[model samples]
Every structure is written in C-alpha cells, then in structure tokens.
Target: MSAFESIPHFDDSRAAAGQQARVEDTRIAAQQFRQHMLNGPKVRYFESFDLITVPYPVRYGLRNAFSRERFVEYMHIQNRLFVVQFDTPDGLKTLLVSPSDHERNIETPFFRRLQDRTAAWLTKLIIKRQSSVPQILERIGLRPEDVDYITYDHLHTQDVRRWLGTDKTPGLLPNATLLVHWREWESAKDLNPYQADWYCPGGIAGIPESKVIGFDGSIMLGDGVALMHTPGHTEGNHSIVVHTDEGLWVTSENGVSVDAYAPLLSTASGVADYAKMIGTEVIINGNTLENAVDQYISMVQEATVAGPSRRDPRFPNVFPSSEMTPFWMFPGTRPAFYVGHARHGTLQRP
Candidate 1:
C-alpha cells in the first residue's frame, strides 16, 4: 500500500483552492483530528531532554523586518529531544523526536564554514550537552533498545548511524526504526547547494533499508500521537502533534520560540512591533528560504492545530524543537515565554 494510504489524512478538498483556502481547510480538518485524538488516549508519557545550546543568526530569526540591527548578532537556541510513548492496539510504542548527536553535528557546513568554525571554537565555552540520550533513558527506567521509533522535524544536521547502527558498529537502539518523510529521506541523500550548509556530511549513510520507514502526509502512530507533514523549512519537514489533558501540542523547528508562532501576543522587546509593522501573524524560522510560502502556510497550520497554551492562552501550544532560551551572554534575544520542559502522564515500565 502507498504511504499516504497507510494512514488517512484529514480532507482538505472540502474547501476551495487558494492559499487562504488551504489554511481554512487545514484548520477545520485539524480540529476534527484533534477531537478524535482526545477521545483516544493521552500519551503514556511525555518528556523533554535538553541536548545542546547553539547560536543562530538574527536575520533568520525575525525575517523581513526593517530593524534587523536592533537585536544581537546571534541568538542562542537550546535544542531538545522529546520522548513520547503511547498505547497502540498491538502494544506500547515509544517515539523519539530530534535525538541529535551534538559532537558529530559540527560537520554541518553552516555559513559555508565560517559559522561551523565559530561553533567548533565555541563548543567548549557554550555548546554543552545537558545530558546524553542514553543517560536520560536509563534514569527513566528505560534502555535505548526500548525505543520503537526515531524521527525528527527534518534531517538537517542529524546523523542516525549511531542510533540504528552501521556495518562497522552496533546501534544504541537495536530495535528502533526511523520514520521519515519520503521527500525528506530523498532530500538528505541528494542535497542541493542551497540545502547543503545545514546538513551534516554523510549523515544518513550505512543504515539498512529495513531499519527505515518512509511515509507521506500525516499519519497517526497510535492514540494521542500523530506526525503531520508541515513542510517548508525543508521539503520533508514535519511536526509532532500530540493530544494531552492540557490540550493539543505540536513540536517542530519551523519557529524558534513561542513568540515566533504568536507574534501579536509577544511581549518581547521588538517582536510585537515588527509584526504590527509588517502586518504579519507568524514569524518564521527563516533559515531556509526555498519554499517560504509553504513554510508560512505550514506555520499557520501548526498554530491552528495546536490552539492555545493552557498556562497562558495568549500563546499557541507549540514547542519549537530548538527553542530560544534566555542567556546572559545574549542580550535582547530572550524569549517572551518559555515552556521549559513538558512532562505529562506516567512512564510505563517494562
């Protein structure tokens, strides 16, 4: 069966054709999907892990703004790994999102080597990993082998050989399978010049074909967890959508922070002002400009699906995989709000 046929997607054909039409259709379909998910089960357990903190460009953070010089040269972003487990008809399923290998990520040709060298030099000073994935799993009464599936918003700087194993070495998650979008899986292998800088060299090599599962559009893994194709940052970029007691939450790297998703409600020094001046609702991640229009629509789709935050309704229930955090060293780049970490339900023990 085709990947799209493996899992059904919400019907967007109900609405007319156009940019606004797509947004409206997605909103309606996502609402129905969210209700169906809520009727099912909440995630068996949900937790976040702080992987590493790195610098990003100001121009990309807030795009098409007149006052780009108002903020610092670079903004600090804290990357996170999410462990989501839920019940399936077959059994329990554990899914990992954004499990980045920080040490090997330096191979990314950021800014054509200038930023890569800068990140390398600053590694000891700032880019410290809070904890390794294995350590976190052990502390939580789990093992790497327990992971059933591994995924990411996009491949970008990701190298999955360590997780799934290569011919020369054994993998940490011996039982894990990589769930990737067909477009993204293809993009990683044949990267163009515009896409090469953000990707780690030879990132997806030496993995057995049986260890990878490719799909298209949206697919519901089990009860409360679903993967939605929110392309734009990359051709195959997607977001993790989960339903919980607090409501619905979507995770992706489309935006760096809550402010980027809800700029009108943002209290950050200049974010709200920029949005008002530009008359735009969403502030994109802006690093990749290949399919900007698609990215904008995708961001809107995410914000619409996620709805509002429980703690603060002013913001959308969206958690950026690489969220912007406050740092003393980086002034004027502090996030207006931070989710810190999202922990929900109880972790099931083997």
Candidate 2:
C-alpha cells in the first residue's frame, strides 16, 4: 500500500512550524499521561548500544569549522550511531538514532547513485564501514519487530525508503515506526540544491504512511526518551535525548563533538581551543547552511536537559553521540560516544 492511499497527511510551512510543534508536544504529553500514568517528574534510566560507526570525510561533516590543522587541510573523521533501550510507560522500547545502515548502498536512487559512483572513482574519498540495522539487531538477539521506534536528528543523506521499504524492497523494520520532525519531512519533499547530493532522490516517496511518525517541537516517546527540536544543523533537525542513571545524553550532529556542544565549559576537545581563541562561544558542525542563532539556542537546550554530570560537576551531563576525534591522529576504527550501561538482550515485554 502506498503512503498516499493509507496515511493521514498534515502539512505546515517553516514560518508556522514552531507553533505547530508546541501544539503537538503538549498533545502528546496529555495523551501519554492519560493512557499511562508515567507522570510528573521521572527517574529516567536506560542502556545504550553502539549500532555502527560511519567513517566520513572531514570536509563533508565539520565543514572546516574547527581550528585544527586538519580543518585547514583535509581528512576524514568517523562518527557513531547508537540504540537506546529503556522502559517506557507503555512497555520496553528501543530508540535508534542515525540509521546509517547501508554502506555500499547500490540501491541508492538513480541520480544520487550516479553522483556517488562518479565521486568514489574520481574526486572524493568516501569510506563507510557500516553495519545494517538488521545485523545489529541480530547481534543483540532481537529483530526488526523488537524495536519500538527509529529516528534521526536530521535526514541528511538518509534514504527512508530503505527502512520503510519501496515498492520493490520490503520494509526492513516491519514493526517499528520511523519518527521524524514535521519540518524535516517537509524539507525532504522539497530540498534545496546544496543538500541534493546527501539525500536520496525521491527517497521518501511511496513508503507506507502507517509506518511513519512525524512530530513537532519536543516529544516524549515515554519516560526517559524524548525527541527535541534542536535545529541549526538543519532547519528541521532535532536531537534525541535519553535520561539514563548517569544523566541525559543527546544524539545529534548539531555539534560534531562534545567540545563543540559545550565550548565555553569544555576544553577536552581541540575545537574548544578554537572557540576560545576566536572569542566566540557558539560552534556549529560546519557543514550545511546553518542558522547560528538557532544553533546557539539549540546547544543551550541540550545542556539544560543534560544538567550536570554526577561523575563530574565541571562538565554538563550531556555527551556527543557523534564524538569528533582529531582525524589526523586517529584516522581509522575509533570508538563512538555512548551513555549508560548497555546489553544486547532480547526485547522485553511489560
């Protein structure tokens, strides 16, 4: 069944999108509480699993946004993708952030495939050592039906068709619904030329609507797991926040590294030096046309949610999902930033 035939459609423009988001968030809260009294303040806790690590070219991600010698030069840095399993008001749920599953995505939409093929052979050096969602699920002794939801901070270069299934391909996550910000979904419908290369051509088309979920502003999937609108990287970009026993950890490329997120309060990462030298507290991921104003606000939102780490009062509780390492030094097979205790166990019920 095509999305057009089955799913209910709600459309909004960028100008009015924020208001719509607030409305949606409030509505979701009321419904969640009424149905399942996971109410008032929540003692949030969850275990995070590393799903995959994507080795990406430096210039493509950080946008030469750092003061590192490599930013002045050129290189590639790898980022991580992870899954968080936690107890929700409804039941046990797994929330996946950044499903960069396909490495040699030969099935990429035609025009994009052509561009990638030419780039790979000629100019750019793009290397992706990836593990598919199914592979990770199996490793964890679970399946597609085991996950409750799948989402991304933004839809940069992502092909929803792979997960949602195209006319030819069966939906990979049969029981899981794809959650996205309404504005991000709108951008996919009509994207600017700059983002053309990253996104799959007609990627969102023809998917079953019933399998997709769109939200505005910030929303709680249940206690401990929430999707917050943390724009700047992309107009519709968002961050997934989960409260573990340790604290809240946010997943988004808004800032390439932990230092990028808290430049003022951190000096652990090299980018922090750049921010200090420049006398500017705010730092963006460096790629994609960004709204610096929006990014500044978003960082604060992330930090506020994170509060202070119990481990260290000096640092905010928040950590980078995509920890930016100095590409020149550790060029291959680096670790991803993750949070809380983790396990690859079978899905839990009630």
Each model's number of backbone clashes? Answer: 0, 2
Q: How do all models score by TM-score?
A: 0.92, 0.72
Q: Model 1: residues >4 Å from true position, as ranges?
A: 1-17, 66-71, 111-123
lDDT of 2 by residue, 257-303 (tens): 55555565544324455566766544666556657556655665566
Quality of model 2 by C-alpha lDDT: 0.56
Decoy 1 TM-score against native: 0.92
Per-candidate Cα RMSD to the true structure, in Å, reads 2.4, 7.5
In order, candidate lDDTs are 0.80, 0.56
Off by over 4 Å in 2: 1-65, 68-76, 104-130, 264-270, 326-350
Best by TM-score: 1
Candidate 2 C-alpha RMSD relative to the actual structure: 7.5
